[model samples]
Target chain A: MTFKLFSEHLLIVVAAEVLALAVGLPLGVLCYFSPKARKPILWVVDVLQTIPALALLGIIMVLAGAGKQTVIIGIALYSLLPIVQNTNLGLLQVDPGVKEAACGMGMGRMYRLIHVEFPLAFPVVFTGVRIAAVNAVGSAVFAAFVGGGGIGTAIYKAIRIQNMNMLMQGTATLMAIAIALDLSMGWVEARIKRGHSSMKKAPARRN
Target chain B: MIKFEHVSKKFGKKQVLDDMNFEIPDGQFVVLIGLSGCGKTTTLKMINRLIEPDEGRIYIDGKDIEKVDKVELRRQIGYVIQQIGLFPNMTVAENICVVPKLLKYDKESRDRIVHEMLDMVNMPYDEYAHKYPSEMSGGQQQRIGVLRAFAASPPIVLMDEPFGALDPMTRETLQDEIKKLQKKLNKTIVFVTHDMGEALKLADTIIFMEDGKIVQMAPPETMLENPANDNIRRFLGKHMNDDAVTLTVEDFMRTNIITVDKHRGVRECTERMARTGVDTLLVVDESDKYIGTVSIKDIRLRGKNEKLIEALITDNAKTVRRDGDAHECFDHLLNSGDNYVVVLNNDDTIAGIVTKNSMAKALSDTLWGDER
Candidate 1:
């Protein structure tokens, strides 16, 4: 029973994160290029994050009629802030010299963003993605209040019936999921960073 | 030819380029030099429309550059910068082919161009092609940066203090290589550098700027002989041999000396000597410290069985510190049987060679005044 609940929780987090990334990446690029659009777009995502997870899901459940889809939408909205903000920051932090070289070499805006700036900015962006994924794991617990079943349902029932054993199991499983997601994503980020620094010795000496 | 007609630009209240008018003829190596705010870089950027002028127009080959699409124009013109901004994510081959790929060249043609470009810098295609920028040295990265610029065979190339960040020795080597490449490729190169020595070495025509205006434009020899103003005279400073009573060895030494690595093969050394028309090649170790000198005669006599020139190096050549008195060095060269005296920096790297011909040329410049 605990194992099945854990998988369902994992499913919600993964699905929500995928949806968030798909919407957030292009929105971040849009924020990077257009100064006028960046203000409103960032403002909306930042406001979305300020809404409490349960209240946000309750509102989504009212609109979408209390299902897993409503919970997924709520978690994805919550995930947008980190993903969008990080993508914008990553592109901004790319080496200016590299950007200038890209433009000077006749690369159009989209070409440079895809080929040069985006690749260099990827490690920073991955860190953002990791943050969102871990946060979403914790946020998915709100799914129980909206009939989107997961470990959260067990925790809710344990709290209502005063069952210590069920509460401990649900809380422990949620914590484990968060930790696992953080560790695995952290590993991937470290691998990307290592690839850059392994050959990072000082330039060759002139013969 | 690139012609700027009444071009002017302003950033807010400060004028960056003030009605700039200049014509660069075909196949000339022109250098733009000035202080930090002199607008030399701004002027270079305007050529490819990276920064559009507030007024007036620029013409390339008599066609208005403003009418040409900026992207297409930039692709047809090569550019290199001081920071050596090669893409960290791309391999050396991919970095070189950036412009070619933009122009939509096929895979076979791009590979051939990459190999040819690497070959021009003596970097073996097999070795460096797959290597990332971080794996290479500063000098090697800059070489690849240069190769990337020229890969598309642009008719004109622009360099903005491209060797500014390198050590003096590496900078000298790159300067020589670039000058040779520019001549061979016959490209009209507009190079910008703050170092007058770099400008003098590489430019056929030198355009000095101040306060967003062209202070003077002339050949290096003419500019040195008759500077347009006191600012230029001050800029020339130590290079003006006329003002000195006790000149140093640096003023007399010709920096265009051919050098060979100690580990290079005997055949390669002979080829370098023959191509550059030098009898002796200064030998430096891997760290680039001057070890000794290797002569063509020594290689012919004792190098028959030798594989590397490291074995053929000998310390018989006379040496002098770069800061040594020019007259004393001249006397030493006349008295010694050696054809030229190797001038060494404080750390013992080869600064230059003070051959009799170079001294004669220096003396002629002193005597002839305004004449070449």
Candidate 2:
């Protein structure tokens, strides 16, 4: 039963991460290329990140009508801050010399971003992805309150019935998942960092 | 040819280029020289449309650059910068092929270009082709940067202090290489640098600017013989002072001399001579002590059968100590039929060369003070 709940929780986090990346990468790039959009977009995502995960799920449930959809949407929205901010910061920190050379070489906007800028900024962007992934794992626990099935539902029932055994198993399972996800993602981040030895550290981001 | 008609620019309230008017003739290496904020960089960026003028038009080969699509226009012109600007993400070959790739060059052509460009700088294709920029030294990275600019074989190139960040030794080597490449490719190069020594060494014409205005524009020799104002005189300070204070071989020698190892192959020696535009080369021993000189004429006459420059070395050129009397050297140059006299250091290493041109330049500087 615990194993089943862990997989479902993993599924929601993965889906939300995918959704967030798809929407957030371009949004970050848009913010980079268009300075006018940067402030407002960052502000919106910053606001999204500050909302309590349970409160965010409740709000999303009202709009999407309760289910896994609401939980996914809520987690995805909550995770957008790190991804979008990191993308914009990563591109900004790219060596100005390289960017100028790309411009001087006659590369179009998209061509430069794909061929030169994006690759240099990849390590930093991936750091953001890692942060979002880890955060989503924790945020996915809000699934129980919005009627989404996951380990959170088991924990919620354990709390209501005062079942110490079930509560310990559910909490322990969540901790294990979070730790495993963090370590594996951290390993992948290290490999990406090794690949781009010239990359600067990602700018600090606020949760 | 590039012509700027009434080109002007202002950054905020400060005028950066005030109605700058100039023309860069085809195949000429024109260097724009000035202080840091004198609009030299702004002027160079305008040609590539990296910065547009507030009021005026820039014409490339008689067409207004404003009318051309910037991306299309930039692809046709090459550019190099002070920061080396090599894309760290790409391999040496990939970085050099950036422009060609953008132009949709076929795979074969791109590979050929990568090989040819690396070969031109003596970087073998098979070895350096896949190495990333971070793996190479600063000098090598800048060399790749230069090759990237010239990859598409653009007819015009703009260099903004391209060697500024390199060490003095590396800067000198890259300067020689760039001047040779500019001549070999017959490209019109507009270079910007604050170093007058560099400007005089590589420029066919030097344009001196101050306060967003052209202070003077002339050949290196003309600028040396006749500076426009006190600013130029100050800019030419140490160089002028060298002529005025002491009449010695050190004061009159051209230190930008080219030398070849005594054991170098005849073909390599001749190639070096051709690249540096010198008819003779000072051959140095294994310890870098001067042995003698080799002339192109002797190479043509008797070097046909010889494989190494060692066998072709001749004592026809006279050698003088670095501290030797300047007037005596001048007299020897005038009376002796030798083309140049080699100036040597105390340890018997070659210091520089004193030819008729340098002697004449020193003489002119003596006759005409920096005032006029």
Candidate 3:
């Protein structure tokens, strides 16, 4: 029973993360190039972040009419803030010296951006994805309220029935999943940092 | 040959190159030198079309550069700049072969070129080729930058203060390496620098500029001897003052000397040598031009009065240009039994004679003047 709930919960969060990155990255890249779109796009995302999670999920539920579709849409929208902001920030943070070196070597604009600028920005962009992944664990629980059953539904039922054993098991499972996900994501972040030696906070290189 | 005809460039209100006309012969190493804002760099970049001239035309090998595609022209002209310009993400070999790759050389050839260039710079190909730019020191990185420029074997290479950022020792090593490359490859090079010492040491011809105008274009020796104006004199400053002037043979040469016609009788030549308190006389032709030297010993052994001094003349007599460094002649005189080095003008006419006594007297005077 717990396995089924954990699987459903993991699927929703992962799906939301993948969807958020796809939509946010291109939108972020577009904002990076076009000044006119930057202001409006960033404002909308910022406003989306300020909206209460349950309130936003309720609004999405009204439009999509509940279940996994509404829950997934709500969580993806919630995660867009970190993904879009970081994509923009990462690109903007690429060293000007590196860009100048690339252009001087006769690399065309598109080639330089893709091959030189984007690679340099990758570690920072991945940090945003990691942050969104961890945050999505908590946000995915909202799916239970909309009748999109996950680990959240089991915890909800345990609380209503005052069953101490079920409550402990449900809460312990979420805690365990969160701890495991955070540790694995942290390891991935460390790996990302190691790949780019030039970055300031990059850990001591292995022999 | 590269020629700039009435070239001018302006950046808003600032005129960088103004009606500049110059010619650089094939295989000559030319250095453009001046103060920071004097447009020496602009002049070099104009050749590769990095910075285009606002007016007038530039021709390389009698073909207008404007007619050539800018990208193609840049690829053909090797360019090394102050920043070293090596892409940090690229390995040394990759950076060196960037232009060669652009030119579409096969993988085998590009790899071979990379190894060859690093080898020429004395950086082992195996050790440095796969290493990224950040892995090397600033000097090593710049050495890769230079090797990259020459990888395609371009007919002309342009350097804009390529070693300006290195320490003195590394700069000297790279300068020597580039000089060797220039000689071995026989490529026409246009180098730009604000460093006068670098200009003097490397240039076959140094073009000194003031306010976007070429104040003087002459060889290092000529430039030191005759600066075009007071502005140039001030720019030359200490370099022209104590070291160059005192060390030059022209300042110490004895201007008034007699030349014996190579066809003159040995009897007359011996008489002249005796009268001048000298054992030898300079042998010249009937045109009153220099031929060689005839010693009294040679004249005596060939005692026939009808025998011409030309018969006794030894062709091994050394000659030095009047504008040449006196120390060079000084060192030569110290190592040889010869009393003098014949000093000649640009026209090759005898300017004067520089002997051990003449240079000593001139140097002693400067030392005493300094003491006073």
Query: Which lDDT value does model 2 have at B186?
Result: 95
RMSD of each: 12.2, 11.0, 7.6
Q: Worst 10-residue stretch by lDDT in candidate 3 chain A?
A: A198-207
**lDDT for each residue of candidate 3 in B261-360, tens digit (9 for 90 to 100):** 7777777877888889888777777666677888888777776654667667886778988878777898889889878899987766778898888877
C-alpha lDDT score of every prediction, in listed order: 0.90, 0.89, 0.83
Per-residue CA lDDT of candidate 2, range B45-98, in tens?
Answer: 999999999998889999999999999999999999887778877788888988
List the DockQ of the predictions in order: 0.28, 0.31, 0.13
Q: Choose 2 or 3, whichever is better by TM-score.
A: 2
**Candidate 3 lDDT over residue span A1-207, tens digit each:** 378898999999889988999899987887787889989999998899888988998998899998988788888888888888888888888765455445545565666778777777778788888888888888888889998878889988988988888878877887787878889988987887775664332111121
Best by lDDT: 1
Model 3: residue A151 alpha-carbon error in angstroms: 3.0
Better of 1 and 2 by DockQ: 2
Interface RMSD for candidates 1 onward, in order:
4.2, 7.6, 7.6
Task: List model 1 lDDT by residue over B15-50, tens digit each.
Answer: 999989999999999999999989999999999888
Give the Å shift of residue A13 in candidate 1: 0.7
Q: Model 2 chain B — which ten-residue stretch has the worst lDDT?
A: B238-247
In model 2, the clashing pairs are none
